[model samples]
Target: MIDSSAFQGKKAIYYTLGCKLNFSETSTFGKMLADMGVVTAEKGERADICLINTCSVTEVADHKCRQAIHKMAREHPGAFIIVTGCYAQLETEKVSKIAGVDLVLGSNEKADLIQYLNDAFIHRAEGTTLHAFHAVKTKDIKRFQPSCSKGNRTRYFLKVQDGCNYFCTYCTIPYARGLSRSPSIASLVAQAEEAAAEGGKEIVLTGVNIGDFGTTTHERFIDLVKALDGVEGIKRFRISSLEPDLIDDELIEYCAGSRAFMPHFHIPLQSGSDMVLKLMHRRYDSALFARKIALIKRLMPDAFIGVDVMVGSRGERPEFFEACYRFLDGLPVTQLHVFPYSERPGTSALTIPYVVDEKEKKLRSKRLLAMSEEKTHAFYEQYIGTERPVLFEKAHRGKAMHGFTDNYIRVELPPSLARDAYDNEIMSIRLGGFNHDGTALKAELT
Candidate 1:
C-alpha cells in the first residue's frame, strides 16, 4: 500500500502525440493524477512529473516518439518521466533504455498508473539506477477501460472501444494495441450523458476499430449508434475512422435523419486498387467501398466524406498507382488523409517480393496529395453560398475564432467579430468563399 499524502502538491505535465484516442487516454491519466492531488505545472515551471503518450503507427512515428522522449527529459531534468501508448508497448526495451524515461508502462498497465508511480518513486529513492518496466509478455485486449476527455478543448472524445482485430499486412497496431474489444453500449451511452451534463456540446466517438464495437459485448455497432443518438444535451456527435466494409446501410440511414449525429464520415480505403487491397489483406474491395460512398451521398448529399489512402505499399506498381488515382478521381470525397506506407518489422508485408523505393514512394504520395487538395477545394467551393450552423470553439481574446459546421466545414470568424461571448456557441451563418489563406471558409453572423 502507498501513502496518499506523498502525492499531495505534486506538479505534473503531459504531452500527447498521435490520434484522438491517445488524447482521450492522456486526459484520463491526468484526471487520475489530479485525484491524487497532482496539479498541472505552470508554464515555464519545472514539473515534478512528466507523462508522455506516444504513437507508433509508422516508422516515422517511432522516430518522432524517440525525439519527444529525449526532449521531455532535457527540458524537465530529474522529473519522473513515464512513457506509454503504442510506441511504448511495441518497443518497450528501446523506450526503457532512453536516457530520461523512469518508467515504461504498456497499454494494459496504464490503468494502474498511480501504483506504478508509487513504486517508481520508492525505487528511485532507494538509489535504483535501472528504469522500472511493466508490460504483458503476450498482449491482452480483453480489458475495456472507458475514458472520456473533458479537457479545455471544445469537443470531448468518448473512447467507446479499444484494440484492433484486423491484422492487415504492413501494420503493427494489432501487436501494439491487442485485439478488438469494446465496452457495453449502455456504459458508453452513460458516459456521453455525463459529458453532456458537463457542458460538452460536441463528442467524437473514438476507438481503434469503432465499427467493430461490441466484439466482447456482443452488441452491434448500429445499436451503439442508436443508443448514443438518444443522449440529450450533446448538440453534435462525430464518428471517427471506420473500416469500409463494416459501414452498413442501417447506420448510414440513421445518421442521415438522426438528431445529433453529424453529416460527416471518415472511412479508411487504404488502397483504391483492388489488387493492392488484396495484397494489404483489407476486408473490402474497391467496388464495395464505392457502393458505400454512393449510398451515403444519396442519403446525405451535403455530407463531408474523408478518406485514408496509403501509397507506395508492396506490389503497388506504377500501373496500380495510376489505377488508384483514376478511382479516387471518380469519388466524391471531401478530403483525403494520405501517407506513404512504411515498413513495419515482424509484419507479413515484408514477405512480398516487390517493394517501393524512397524516391518512388515520395513521388506517389505527392500525386495523391495533389489530387486530394483539388477535391477538397472543390467540395468547399460548392457550399460557398449556403447557410449552415457552426459551433464555435473557445479561442484567445485577440485571435480569430473558428468552428465546424454540421457537415464538418471549418468556418472562421474574423478577429473583429471574434468575441469571448461568442465562444462555444452555435449560430447560423452564411458561408462565404475561402478566407485569405484558403485554409477555411469565411463566415459572418446571420
Candidate 2:
C-alpha cells in the first residue's frame, strides 16, 4: 500500500512532449494521482513532485527531453522527479544517472504505474533520493491502457489504441511502442459515456498507428466509431492521423454520413515518389494517397485534408524530391506537415544507402514548408466571409481567446468579450480575415 504520509498533501506537476497520445496518457496519470489526494501544483507554485512524459520519435526529440529534464531538475530541486514514456523505455540507463530523476517507468511498466510507485515508496529509505528504473519490453501484448485528456485542452482526447505493427524503414515507433493493441469496443464506449457526463464537448480518438487498431481480437475501428457516435452529450468526434492505405471507402463514407465525425483527415504520406515509398517500406504509393484525398473531396467538398510528408529520408535523390513535390502539388490537400528525417538508432533506415546531406535536407524542407504556407493561405481564403461554428479553448493569450472550427480552422475572439463565457463553448463566428501570416483566422461573433 502507498504511504499516505508521502502523498496526502503533496502537489505534482506534469510536462509532456510529442503526440496527443502522450498528452492523454499523462493526463490519465494526473487524474489517478488526484484521486489519491495529490493535487496538481498551482501556477508559479513549486511542486513537490514533477513528472516528465517524454518522446523519442527523432534525434531532436531525444535532445529536447534531456534538456527539459535538466531544466526541471534545476527548477524543482527538492521535488521527486519521475520520467516515463518512449525515451525512458529506450534510454533508462542515461536517465537514471541524471541529477534529479528518482523514478523511471517504461511503456509496459507505465501501464501499472500506480502499483509500482506505491511499492517503491514503501521500500525506500525515508528522505533519501534514490533512483530506480522499471521498463518491461512488450511481448504478445493483450491489454490496452485506458486514457483521456481534459481541462487544459479544448477537445478531450481518448486513447482508443496503442503500439504499432507496421515497421516502416524510417520509423522507430513500432519498436518503442510494440505491436498494435486496442481496448475492446465496450470499454471505449463506456469511457465516452464518462467523458460526456463530465461535460466534455469534443472527443478526438488518438493512437500510435490507430489504423492498425485491432490486431488482437479482430475488432474493427469502424465498430468503435459507430459505437461512440451514439454516446450522448458529446458534440463532435475526430479521428487523429490515420494512415493513407487504411482510409478505406467504407470508413470514409461512414464518417461522411455521421453527424458527430468532423470533415477533417490527417493522413501520413511520408513520401510521394513510388520509388522512395518502396525504399522506405511504406505500404501505400503516391497514387493511393491521391485517391484517398479525392474520395474525401468527392464526398465532402469542403473537407480539410491534412498530409504528413517527410523531407529528406534516405534515397530521396533530387529527382525523387521533384517527383514527390509534383505529386503533393497535384493533390487536393489543404495543409502539409513537413518533417526532416533524422536517423534513429537500430532502424532499417540506417542501412539504406545515399543519405541526403543535412544542408540539402534543410533546403528541401524549406521549399515544402513554403509550399505549405501558400496552400494554407488558399484554404483559408475559401472560408473567408463564410460562417462556421468554432469551439473556443479555456485559456487566453494576453487579450485574445483562441479556438478551432469543425473543418480545422484556427480562430480568435476579440479582447472586449467576457472570456470566461466563451471558454469551452461553441459559437457561430463569421470568418473575417487572416492573422499571423495566414496561420490563424480573425472572427466576428455572429
- TM-scores of the candidates in the order shown: 0.98, 0.97
The 10 consecutive residues of candidate 2 with the worst lDDT sum are: 135-144
Per-residue lDDT tens digits for candidate 1, residues 1-446, read 97677789989999998999999999989988999999999899999999999999998999999998898899999899999999998889889999989899888888888998987777766888547777775356456667987666889999988888889998988888888888888889999999988888899999998999988889999998889989999989999888998999999999999999999999999999999999999999999999999999999999999999999999999899889999999999999999899999999999999989999999988888888889889989999988999999888878889999999999999888888877778899899999988888999788
Query: Residue by residue across 1-446, what tens digits does model 2's lDDT show?
Result: 66666567888889899998999999999988887779999988888888899999999999899898898889888787889988998887788788888889878778777776666566565644457997766564434688976747768999988988888998878767778988788988899899888888899999998887776768898888888989988889999889988888999999999978999999999888999999899998887888889999999888888888998999999999999999888888889999999999988988888889999999999999888888888988999999999999876545778888999899877676537878889889999899765678898887
Cα lDDT of all candidates, in order? 0.90, 0.86
Candidate 1 accuracy as TM-score: 0.98
Q: Candidate 2: deviation at residue 34, Å?
A: 0.8
Q: State the displacement of the C-alpha of residue 234, model 2, in Å, after optimal TM-score superposition.
A: 1.0
Clashing pairs in 2: none
